[model samples]
Target: GATPSIDRFDPDLTIRGLLEIWRRNASLKD
Candidate 1:
């Protein structure tokens, strides 16, 4: 059996975090 791993600092995670941050900021500005 293989265990899945979570990478908090992965590039994908960072990109997603930035996207979410931008989305929230954009919503606040609207």
Candidate 2:
């Protein structure tokens, strides 16, 4: 099988990573 994505590793880590992405997205919208 193929390697899993970040969220597949751990829920907590996925949430933190997702928050970072959201912040990046917000900045891009500015």
Candidate 3:
């Protein structure tokens, strides 16, 4: 077992965060 933190969160959160970042960057390009 391991303690989860920003450096070790569940994969889902990481992917979602990356998606949100990408979306925000795309919006700024318009």
Instruction: Check candidate 3 and list the clashing pairs.
Output: none
Q: List the residue pairs that clash in candidate 2.
A: none
| Per-model root-mean-square deviation over C-alphas | 6.0, 2.7, 4.9
- For residues 1-30, what per-residue lDDT tens digits would candidate 2 score against the true structure? 434665367888878878999999999999
Error of 1 at 8 (Å): 6.6
Looking at model 3, residue 18 earns an lDDT score of 88
Q: In angstroms, how far off is 13's CA in candidate 2?
A: 0.4
Query: What digit string (tens of lDDT, one per residue) describes model 1 on residues 1-30?
Result: 222444436778878978999999999999
Q: Flag the better candidate by TM-score, 2 or 3.
A: 3
Off-target runs (Cα >4 Å) in candidate 3 are 1-7
Q: How accurate is candidate 1 locally (lDDT)?
A: 0.77
Q: Which whole-number lDDT from 0 to 100 does residue 14 have in model 1? A: 73
lDDT of the candidates, in the order given = 0.77, 0.80, 0.84
Candidate 2 displacement at residue 24 in angstroms: 0.2
Q: Which stretches of candidate 2 lie over 4 Å from their true place?
A: 1-8
